[model samples]
Target: MISVGGYYCSGRSNGHHLQGVAMVISNRLQSSVVEFTPVDECIMVMRLKLAFGFMSLIVVYAPTDVCKLDVKEMLHAKVASVLDRCPQRDICVVLGDFNVVSGCDRAGYEMSVGPHGSGADAGSKNRLLFRDFARSQKLRISGSWYQRPNPLRWMWYSDVGNAAKKIDHILVSTRWRILQNCRVYRSAVVPIINWLWLPSGSISKLPSGPMITLGCFPWTG
Candidate 1:
């Protein structure tokens, strides 16, 4: 299985680009496509009872603008449920705009600014949960730096400079052998031609081949 993720910052100024992405991706995948949620981000999430092993994948886009209290809570709740459903899953990959800043895997790709507050209702709570959940499941967060587009300013109505941090990620479960960490690369991109503005030469090219798999050979254990 393969997973793709990108941030759709609700800047609301980029509706044209979002529409383009939907069209291109939809046309490429199989007609058996499935939607995993009532939300915009979801995976095909097919189950294959192969002779070798079963395969499952989940694609999630954490609620945008996480400074919003309700959105943050909704993300944590749904994420916990999604992981709970697949424990020993063979090939599980979770990717998208998590909008989370703290919580790095032990291998150390994510550089978390030490959360600066105390209490059950502060920034620390987010860091604590983000780290704890991944560890409890034996899931692996790619410890290597994956490419992410530059982050925009904090969306909160308040100024918390340190709160600004990376939110996109590519996480895989404990099942697959990571043949090469190099497969995960972030596309450092600038939108030169937005199709929404110009039709002929306005389309931006997505960087080719991030998170590559050698082949879709099934696992048997």
Candidate 2:
């Protein structure tokens, strides 16, 4: 565990220098952290003691769209195994840059996606895989639950500034009402990132739940 500016960070570095995943918790809630496990360079798990039971947080940097299908499936399988081991009573949240565009069509995926996604109508291989994973796990895409402008949904942009894609996402348990709002901030000099605010009283006694941030960086195939 490492502390920086009153925040505790946990993660695994695979020596690639360009790939890794981490979770940062505010010092105010440091006492709540009961376990932190680094699954791999691309995944990390953190458990926090909550008023009711526990909150399991999985931070992941999934394979890009260009990667082979088998490679992408492997990461999802690893995440699934981790989720299976969590306590049934724990609040599970899977958040990260999944690098897939889960379009707004809720057709058969009513359990996983909401009514407000922005992307391709006909699902791509990556999109379909991501959606199936969420559906199988009974998790909802947090950003799609709340309505936002289409532009705000785009989480990645091209270097030429002519194209943008909604790849980064935060998936939460379909049963929890913890997230109040999710906002994306676009900057000319930095890659897009999302800020999620947990409303007061959502997480039992923890009135001020930890604010979660998901960031996406440019990647080349």
Candidate 3:
């Protein structure tokens, strides 16, 4: 099982540039690709889950630097709300372009050279919240276990990693043991990336990352 998502951040207009709004993947979550007249910037979250029999894989996505603590809380809450409602007969895989960083607890350094010198203070508290939440829920981060720049994606911006960080992720539940393989997809020319798991068969990361056509994500169980 696999899932993919693209989040549209209501980030300052300076962060993202766009003309009109359209094609909302999850209107129920109040996400939009375009802002309607002085409205809040739209946001999106995508998840992929591979269930041996009945497990669920949740998609993950978040806006960049949401200052209001209450809003941040709601962001996490809404994601949790969706995941909770999903069936738990199988394991879960939550991942995607999370604007914030979550703390990791597996072992040593996961991503070696991010070009951005550790990205420590870039949402340290939010990272802690994720770390604590993962501990409480028994979820494991997939890519980190490798301890290498496992899946390197090119950022549209400069190589400073300033425009990018290991913000995207693929988190799985502990119960799902025998499964562990993740990869990043990037276009030979495009700087953006897409994350894939179970990574077998016809998948390559040499630029031209995982080319996903239908932008819409799959529904998890």
Candidate 4:
């Protein structure tokens, strides 16, 4: 395994050999890390000391629509536990490949989600689960708030390559204002593509104080 940053933490799953979650703490940010907890292959939490107080960043990879209901429920439970542990006053940012398409319907979820979301799939239970989590945690769906071009909004494409959907997302506390510049950067290429190429869906930036950048890429076998 190649290591780029200084501190590395990971959680591996026994059932699926390739299923795992990891976080690489940059040397510059290493000193701010209060604690890092890897709940399982699908979830991890990192607490950092900020100028104001503390900040909790929870990264997750939820099961896709094909996964069983029990699997999705378990993942949500694990994520909720981590959020519950975070102090209420601290800023919380939950992000990653949710694998759920939150449609552009902001009827009842006007405060939590925006109307700029991509079209949603009718049969995805993951969508409902995500909405519930956002409501419970009082977190706003950061990705859905920005109005961008169609290509920038879609984070996943159909296998046949005809259609696209916004499956990945970044959810942050509503207290922070999501700048208009926050958008998904599609077609971004890594410098080491000559030796090892990875498909990247989007690069999202939280252009707030100090600034935080997050990238979402799914691994395909």
Number of the top-ranking candidate, with lDDT as the measure = 2
The TM-score leader among the candidates is 2
By lDDT, highest first, what's the ranking?
2, 4, 3, 1
For all predicted structures, in order, the TM-scores are: 0.46, 0.80, 0.52, 0.78
For model 4, the superposed segments whose C-alpha errors exceed 4 Å read 1-9, 13-17, 178-181, 187-210, 216-221
Q: Give Cα-based local distance difference scores for all models.
A: 0.37, 0.71, 0.41, 0.65
Question: Candidates 2 and 4: which is better by TM-score?
Answer: 2
Question: Which residue pairs in candidate 2 collide?
Answer: none
Instruction: Give candidate 3's error at residue 193 in angstroms.
Output: 12
Candidate 1 per-residue C-alpha lDDT over 8-60 given as tens digits, one digit per residue, 9 for 90 to 100: 11111333323111111222233323432222332223332322344444445
Q: How many clashing pairs does model 1 include? A: 2
Cα error of candidate 1 at position 90, Å? 3.5
Ranking by TM-score: 2, 4, 3, 1
Which sections of candidate 3 miss by over 4 Å?
1-51, 103-118, 121-123, 150-164, 188-221
- Taking the candidates one at a time, how many backbone clashes does each contain? 2, 0, 16, 0
Q: Which portions of model 2 show Cα errors greater than 4 Å?
A: 1-18, 187-221
- In terms of lDDT, the poorest run of 10 residues in model 4 is 189-198
